[model samples]
Target: MSEAGPRLGGRRHSDERSSPQRSLGQRKPARTITIDGEHAGRRLDKFLRSQFKGVPAGLLFRLLRQGKLRVNGRKAQQNHRLQEGDVIDVPELHVDTAAAPRPAVPSTLLDQLRGAVLHEDDDLLIIDKPAGAAVHRGTDVSAGVIEALQHLRPELPELELSHRLDRGTSGVLALAKTPSMLRYLHGLLRDRKHEIERHYLAVVAGRWPADMDIVDAPLRREEDGVVVAGDGQSAETRVSVKRRIGNRATVVDVRLVTGRKHQIRVHLSHAGHPIAGDDRYGGRAFNRRVTGLGGPGIYLHAAKLVIPKPDGADLVVTAPMPRRWKALLNSDL
Candidate 1:
């Protein structure tokens, strides 16, 4: 994606947090927006997701089915490719007041984010995302890193997430500044033809086996959040023991072979060494102990990533372990 689009001024529509200050129960009027070069060629559903970060895909699809969303004055499929100059017809919408959108991101947090930037080019912006922050807004979160970036740089075109880090996990997060760059990254991540190394640092309960080198299992997320081990998509992780904390815990390096939701947590828990602070995956006791010891939020950090750049050179990005983590692990991080 070449940087060939007009940079729009004013608050970006992409940031739900920057939406006009309206009462939660208020209903917004219908709108007609003309597509521009920056957003052209994107699928309607994906584009909508980028705009309405808090809205669910199901509800967005329902809006299309109800004829509340249209392209060029006619209903169109979600996969429809938008072109420059095309008009988007949008109907009245009830903003999810439940999210409690913030009118602005606190200047302190924005400044922290600016300082966290790892790399930035014309096509991409990479940052070391904090562990507690989400990649995108959701039902419980008013805004995520993307929304804050949108608020921070309203002159830039709609920013798209090339990859996501779980709210509980922190590391290098990348955002594509253009639609074409976003599409390219999406294809690269999904196809897996190219090897992208995503390495994580985790502290887990008990000593990890020296003989056990890898965890190759199937995973499925259940309603209760306990990912089933043997009955889902194939997921694999390469684990190497980094150090042992006086026989109380083990710090390990985890590399993802197949990225699946909760794969590391599931694999570790299944192997009887759940992450020290991951209460969701059968580590409640360990988590409580970790809290007593002042461990990190989840005893997990997306520590590093190696990705291929547009020029075919490998870009290696890494996030340092928290100071607290270093102190707790006795300099093992």
Candidate 2:
């Protein structure tokens, strides 16, 4: 036998060098510059973008839009021109450290999904999003449902969120699969005649009559960016008590006739029955009770939503109670 001891063709080895892949978390340090002499008169954002060559334009623009980078120690508009001796603070952008890790869709949030099939056509998906999760990235929040969905559906390159949701409030959230769908959805949202129907569920801290209640209050931004107004622009909210949880709290359903910043929270607070766990608007006593019940997140959930469907049908979706909320409720209550 031609010695079968060493199978020459079966195995082979060679010397090779493989480079380590760069991680998404790797980031460059932010550059800061003092505004002096001629550069003082330029817009703050424009100046920063010029200084940071490779930085994304959208990132810089969003920072300016949110008033993160201030001019002369004050919030400046994107078009605000700078002046001499102005100190410009450019904060470093923290890259996503776990970008390399596979994203996960929490099973806890799965129960909240509800709605009618409005449009099933390719390149577009319209569904009502429950409250709590944000629509996009902001200073207070980083990732949301849209981000997770993108991770789940990575094949769709142009997927984008078409609207927003308040961190405490819930309602319709639309996603665009293509550029055309994005444009169309934006236009629809901008149009007032679309007659979108949005609804909410709230547990307030007082007794309310079983009748339709209307609140006409105005809102405006305070110096700290929190929306508040004694005599601001006109805003309206309609509410009805679904049931009385107890003498201490009432389960109310609200219909926002006009969308305003913190409209529900403020209106309910003004009504002397702020939503439970609403520390900002609710009274200290009520907030304390919520906290004692293992509280941190808001009690509000985007219970339901209804919007004009893409195929001339109505689309409605719902998000269920976060596990934490259910745990807070005593079985007797």
Candidate 3:
């Protein structure tokens, strides 16, 4: 919906409008899209789906196979990741032209996000991402934090996610307002430089030992859909007990020394103190218990980030602990 693209090389009458509710199976005029910073690294299918909302995935793949989708004037595949300045050609297909009919983002959430802005300059935007929201659309999520921001700020066409936080995790989500900033930040993260450090707050099951802080484990993804330690890529995390909540749980601060897939969740689980409400790592019983106490999903937050800038001053951003976590922390349980 929302007029997926600005018509290129086409003359339109002042009063004519394409049907608002056209079926995806019907034919329409072809259109071209020039990739920009926001869409640079997105997959072909995912990008197309975002543009032509309501189109089925299977049909999208079929269109790709039929050469209905082209990149830079050549046929492309669904998995093709778009690059900056690349041109995409989309064939005619029945598509909705109205704004997406999805539910509007809650005003409370929007207000929270608006108030959560930690830092913003010409190059970057940092927000305290709320829990239970994806950074971008994926699997079952149709619109995510970034999409919501795009809707709220239509003028920021170059806004791009610098890094990602899990859908269930909260706090300190960084976005790039320019491609160069995105690349620079990514480089710092990739090189594991001390210029940028990420810290998280996690509530875990059991009373964590005060001195048992480091978890160095190599992680590997197995064919069975599990990430196991001792036989994979190198990974490390620095853990410290922040608060002990009786014997039921402990609030801990985690420093991701080497980021990997589900690194914090898997390492903490392997260390025998899985983060509460982490369904994939923490058992279902633990999740039920935590939720039973009115805590939301996984109690992990990207609480703080420290970045060194060219002028020598550090850009430090911190997000307040969620109220539920605070309640749990101060509770007897």
Candidate 4:
């Protein structure tokens, strides 16, 4: 097993010692213990509560659920029993540590960028995201827009991302300010009743007509670890060509009526005109054309989103094309 360090797409560690003035008050150092001959056969949670006094049972359970409490450096369930010679790793708990800090966003650029507000109430915030930024932590990155938002609003009781966005694609990003709101949003997503509307803009390899195009395909994980599957489950995507770019490419707008993993990219690729700069699904010749126009990020953007407001109204948000995309059009492609 690998030794744990700072998690990818997670917050940066503070070098300063824990202080009372900090948002999360002074924390007790984590304690690691090995079950020896005398100390054996104890329920993990039961033992932990006894060791750390004043910590709430609910909080302890949450830590365990989040995999913060581990046995032998591996995640252990709440009901797991510890035997002799087992090592328990306990994470430090700080007073007022409601949620982790969010990443910092530069104030200068915040005003310049047009981030359309999708839905905003006393308990929730949903923004229409652009393509360049990531939504969460993952293999290669740490700080994302969600983290940066957290840093901007540390006073929020419980800020959490309700859904995910691919690093290259973007759309409506929902944030819950309270646990109840988070649970509500989760239920909405699970029931497929998240009334949020999502749309995308892409430059595809070939010219498609203005007629409505629906691609119904199923997606599953491929052997290469990327998602790919035959038409096992129903996945639907609606595409309409907005304009023709050059001899080889056309600007298209896609509306995802039914959200699926890589639905647009997969469907468009399967249709033969993969999105420009999309190396994974795009043909080499199309990629070369986009590359010759600009550099190497996918030329797909989350164009628009519309969602019903909490107060019985509608909110429509849109993110304009990035400068690079405009530059690509200006160049001879």
Q: Judged by TM-score, which candidate is best?
A: 1
Reference-based TM-score, model 3: 0.70
- The total number of steric clashes, by the backbone 3 Å criterion, in model 2 comes to 4
lDDT of 1 by residue, 1-333 (tens): 223322344322221112354454656655566776667888999888766655667877899988778888898899999897777776667766666455556566677688888888777788888878878777887678888898887666567788888787877888888777788777777766786788999888889998898998888878887575566898889999998987778989999988788889889999999987786885677677777776648878888888887789998888888666866687322
TM-score of candidate 2 against the unseen true structure: 0.59
C-alpha lDDT score of every prediction, in listed order: 0.77, 0.61, 0.77, 0.67
- Model 3 lDDT per residue over 218-243, tens place: 89986654476567999989999988
TM-score of each: 0.77, 0.59, 0.70, 0.64
> TM-score order of candidates, best first?
1, 3, 4, 2
Better of 1 and 4 by TM-score: 1
Residue pairs clashing in model 3 are: none
Candidate 2 residue 128 Cα shift, in angstroms, is 7.9
Worst 10 residues of 4 by lDDT: 7-16
Residue pairs that clash (backbone atoms under 3 angstroms), model 4: 9-137, 9-142, 102-151, 103-147, 103-148
2 or 4, greater by lDDT:
4
Residue 297 in candidate 3 has what lDDT? 89
lDDT of 4 by residue, 10-92 (tens): 32211112223334456766666665432355467766664453576787888888889788899888778767668777777
